[model samples]
Target: MTGAGGNPAPSLPGRFGPSFDVRTVVVEPGGSRVYDEAEWRGAIVLLERGRIELVCSDGGRRAFGRGDVLWLEGLPVRALHNPGREPAVLLAISRRPARR
Candidate 1:
């Protein structure tokens, strides 16, 4: 996925350009968490199993399940709405340069 004006999505893997950091994050089911954009850069949160509720900065919340891909924009993440019976595995990739 690309950003405004066709800018490529911030990611770590690449043929060229600055490489961003990548990490795996796991969220337990029936749990909710929040992270700011300053903390988490652009990331593709891949849902491995169970369910995850995603809440954007604009108060938008949605649930995603296994094999689902979620694009995390450089904005304040409100919460992770996971109301399932299992844990949720997420691959969080932070690729934005630190603010000076």
Candidate 2:
């Protein structure tokens, strides 16, 4: 699940402090997703979707298609939108180092 901002929660090991993680997420067509900022362990989340819209808390929106790579920082993510015209799928990877 996403955190307060628009980022997902960091991995279990990162709950304590700064760390990194990689994850894969899927977004169906006409569906929407949210990722909280604090949940992110300072990792950049790479997303690949099939015709979907990425929404940010600051009202920043981006449309992505298949084979597209979207990057997310440790800032709270607002929302992810799928128009529903077709099924949209997303693969997300978060990269960060474990906290010592």
Candidate 3:
């Protein structure tokens, strides 16, 4: 799905395996974080505080603030940037797929 800016929405990298995990991340203002496509294949991310910009491999960018949630499936995230003056906090969650 494309966001208001016409950038494709972030999606889970792949199908979740057989586990569930959650993590907290904090990024300072002007700081950026990068994730390898091979990692976080099927993860979900929640913005807990501040503002961040999600930049995709396709050159698409989207800004997200607190209360925003992102599903990292097909979204090729190149990097995440903190655009605000304050720090940005994020909650990352991943669940494994149910056994068939």
Candidate 4:
């Protein structure tokens, strides 16, 4: 949910701070997948295995390898593809929205 000033409210409030939700994303060898920008707007993505390449909306591209961590917020990323011959795994961690 949204809080004052139109910011996102956390699912778990208080001392420990916000709760997080994690999702697994796997891209097969030579395969591509659309990035879920809406759900992962401010997410932290961790490359678990293999490699990942981002296709940018502005015609640019970037690549990441295993054990790499990145934030996708405000990034103009369009799609994610695996350039290697093995499947790539990533963990997307995002804040859990407050309940109504």
For each candidate in turn, the TM-score is 0.60, 0.52, 0.66, 0.71
Q: Rate the local accuracy (lDDT) of all candidates.
A: 0.64, 0.56, 0.71, 0.75
lDDT (Cα, 0-100) at 27 in candidate 2: 62
Q: Pick the candidate with the highest lDDT.
A: 4
Model 1 CA lDDT for position 64? 82
Candidate with the larger TM-score of 2 and 3: 3
Q: What lDDT score goes with residue 39 in model 1? A: 45
In model 2, the worst 10-residue window by lDDT is 9-18
**Clashing residue pairs, backbone N/CA/C < 3 A, model 1:** 30-82, 53-81
lDDT by residue (1-100, candidate 4, tens digit) is 4433353443322323457766666678899888666756777877877899999999788999998998876668888889999878777777788889
Q: What would the per-residue lDDT of candidate 3 be over residues 1-100, giving only the tens digit for each residue?
A: 3322353333432233347655556677898888565555576788867899988888888999998998766677888899899878776777756779
lDDT of 2 by residue, 44-63 (tens): 44444347776867788877
Would you give me the overall lDDT of model 2? 0.56
* Clashing residue pairs, backbone N/CA/C < 3 A, model 4: none
Encode model 1's per-residue lDDT on 1-100: one tens digit a residue. Answer: 4422354444523433355555556566577767655445566666656788778778987768887877776555687777888766665655667768
Task: Give the winner by TM-score.
Answer: 4
